[model samples]
Target: MITISNLKKIYNNVLVVNVPQLEIAKGESVGLVGNNGAGKTTLFRMILDLIRPESGEVISNGEAVAGHENWKNYTASYLDEGFLIDYLTPEEYFYFIGGLHQQTQAHVDDFLSTLTDFFNGEILKKGKYIRDLSKGNQSKVGIASCLLQKPELLMLDEPFANIDPSTQIRLKNMLKSMNKQHGVTTLISSHDLSHITDVCDRILLMEKGRIIKDIATSSSTLAELEDYFAVGQSATLLPQIDEEENH
Candidate 1:
């Protein structure tokens, strides 16, 4: 559903993203695993045309993404709370997103009912604006609103961040079900190896600004990534076990 070629992004003379060519097929769940400065978000912004690439182009279903509006008709993305209107309640936000795709309020309500497990009862009818919710709750709202669109292509950056372990599992299951039931193509970028390996059909390991590893998710993908990251190659890997998070 997506093709990229000669894509490049530079910030302050440092090339942040420079992919020569990449393609993601329809109905494929792909995961991008890399530490900070790996160019995941930069690549995403370029794909969405939120940032102009230094060179080359992204093609979404045969249409160039940089100057086209039609690809967005089938795409929905959530990178952070920036995608959400903080002033709106969860219900209002979901409705607004759904309405953009011509979905009715009744349709959004029915769809949200299916996401109760993912929400864990904190998202709806709480009478709280989205800005007032906890960070994790805000993530839930963003993700749920994305799914409500029934998008053909979905991109989520760090979906696992700030979410509790239990909700994380629920989200993994929900993503899996979405792929199986609706054939939604998914792209998830994360530092969490376990969850990404468990959920994605394929994993792309990125470093600096290039894709270094592209492997099909398999029986040993987790162990292989762990072993690859265990070498403490300061040039390649981030230090494991961030101390600040523990405190």
Candidate 2:
């Protein structure tokens, strides 16, 4: 399980994200939703130990995560293009990441074996640098790298961006299967409410750098989500509608 206590991030002496407490149990699928600059990415980075929070603690599996020495062993994340290796080919990138994570070459081969039928041959045969590959293909490679490690916690930021609709559907199915089959806790951020509503068990709505609303999938819809981001309305409005529907 991952736990956060009084987490806060400050930029130029201004408060950004401040979560007094939050916890994600094992095998849970949670979606982080927000408008631009809502501190979603910053919070995610803190969870990955990529950036230090100004104060408070982020713990994973009973260990402090901010400077945890073994973070790579339990966490896998793909936040942006910065995670990609421009100079390496797709196959080489996989090997590199796997090796850094202490996975044997055979482990890489075994992991890719399952995905062999899923990917077209072109990505495997692309001898050129990963930077030369199309954006969609590159995203496929990045995702494949993260899954190769098979980490306990998977944090993905906008996993569907820049990919084709067909591939997006495929990825969604893959993630859903992973959650069900492996019980891997996943935290994904997306602007598309449909994506969150379709895959996530719970959703956290972030606005102006704070989580203003938290709702389970059984309690919400895409249209309601649209209104949440439209005018920065009060979250109390949601529960009232839910109450009215029950009556």
Report the number of the highest-lDDT candidate: 1
lDDT of 2 by residue, 181-205 (tens): 9998999999978988788988888
Candidate 2 global CA lDDT score:
0.84
Q: Provide TM-scores for the models.
A: 0.92, 0.90
lDDT, candidate 1, 57-163, per-residue tens: 99999999977899998898999999999999999999999889899999999999998888898999999999999999999999988888888999999999999
Where model 1 places Cα greater than 4 Å from the true spot, the runs are 232-247
Query: Which TM-score value belongs to model 1?
Result: 0.92
- Model 2 lDDT, residue 152, Cα: 84
